[model samples]
Target: MTADTNTDLDTAQLPPPAEKSARALARARKRRSVARFWREYRTHRSGLWGLAGLILIALIAICAPLLVGADSQSVTDAPGGALEAPSGEFPLGTDQFGRSVLALLVWGARVSLTVGLLAAFLCVAIGTVVGIVAGHFRGWYSTVLMRVTDWFLVMPTLVLAIALATVMSRSIWTVILAIGVTTWPTTARLVRAQTLAVESRPYIERARALGGGHRHIMLRHVLPNVMPLVLAQTTLVISGAILTEATLAFLGLGDPTITSWGGMLQDAREAGAVSAGDWWYLAPPGLAIALVALAFTLCGRAIEAVLNPKLGVAR
Candidate 1:
């Protein structure tokens, strides 16, 4: 009785330690993982150089007018009229219509970069959703989705892109759409593989057992886990997208009004720059396109190395 008189410790009233909710804990883990991944990614020397180059190109694109003092859009105001050789006044020379080659190159940077980024974004957005749904649902859902993806996959991306670009208007946005649509099959395939791996993890099973709906689990758990792969794939895709845009422009499938690197090349071709010995015009845009693509490629390879260490034989 005396012992009973000692009030039982009110365990219920004792506050539980401030444990994070499952979502919060997951978010914290993701943050840590991302930090680790970034740390690993930065160690890649080629990646660092690629990052620097990309930043430089982006800056050049952003400050086009200030750096060149030439209007890319103007056809008549070129400092030196008609294919002037590179010199103090008009470096990078002039195009057929008296447009400053320097300015055209600068402005073209904006177009090419814009198309690459936007198209990659579109691919990632579409690919991620399709991949998650196909990976998680299984059975008929996965079968149908995979089949459709395979259908797109079998077709050559460049050929399909050309066909689509021909059917669509020759505009920057149209080019973006064409490339995005053609390129997503690869992204979808990659994302789906990653999603499948993620979905198989024990935490996903636990999430399923905990009464988490498909939407909740997929969005809250699956997508976050697969983002690294998606990101790396997106980087690779950007370089491809830029190349595709340039090719399209070079082939005269691009908007005639927009002054892109490809357009510059196309103009050069039309104006006989290739045959007329205008190496200045011919080389600059071509080199810019190649260098920019190389930068992205190097960065993408670095990211792939970090995410998939097996690929990092040199590292």
Candidate 2:
């Protein structure tokens, strides 16, 4: 190549001297942190297994329409007799309404998982906001917020949820709302502790000296630091939320029009499945609930271990 052509190529390859913006640096750091977290999380075998199970269950719920037709819920057009035991025609048998037990299980997963995830996220969102505000702001505001959280903390969560569900409409949304409101106290407390610790750091004073407002301080500094604790708490909250949904459904508080794990148990009880020794009708839903709860619990524990290696050592 000519000297002029080689000089032009070298000049074109030169990088600009300008540094990355503060926002860009923050985003890069966040991406790196998330990548590190995932790498650490994969080291936990139990966490990987639990994550796989959750993905499988979620996929099944999302693909329910393709796997089983919507007609599976039709009582009049049921493919088998009412309360039929497992046979060549019906693998999991039939419920009291003559619907295929296998179809009911699949459909129930959608509702149960929906309620669990929505309720858990709603609770965590509220909890994170409350905890951050309470921790960052002192005096009466913090006192009032903490007092409210404490009241919810001291009271029976299930009782509050039951009362809310009973007074409100009987629907999936209502169930989600009830569980979310009642189960947020623990999360709030945990996040508040983390927030307090973060606020005590030296950089917090530096941010304030540079004229950071409350919004800027909390969003830029406090929230990111406390997010790990919040994330860990969410998976644990999901398990409790699922259990609460099941309890509410079992108590006949869930919308009767839909099929859910707890609703199936309630139906089997009402239909004398237990009286007639129909194990197929009762066992599947019960086992499904137990398995889902266990999966979430394992995931939460694994996440905790990833965040705090000391906990893993303690275990």
Q: Which candidate tops lDDT?
A: 2
By TM-score, the best candidate is 2
Model 2: residues with Cα > 4 Å off, grouped in runs: 1-28, 313-315
- Candidate 1's C-alpha runs over 4 A off are 1-35, 70-72, 313-315
lDDT values of the candidates?
0.87, 0.92
TM-score of each: 0.88, 0.91
lDDT of 2 by residue, 24-62 (tens): 787999899899999988888888888999999999999
In candidate 2, how many Å is residue 146 off?
1.1
- Report RMSD for candidate 1: 6.5
22 Cα displacement, candidate 1 (Å): 9.4
lDDT tens per residue, model 1, 107-219: 99999999999999998889888988998998999999999999999999889989999998778899999999888888888888988888879998998899999999988
- Candidate 1 contains a number of clashing pairs equal to 0
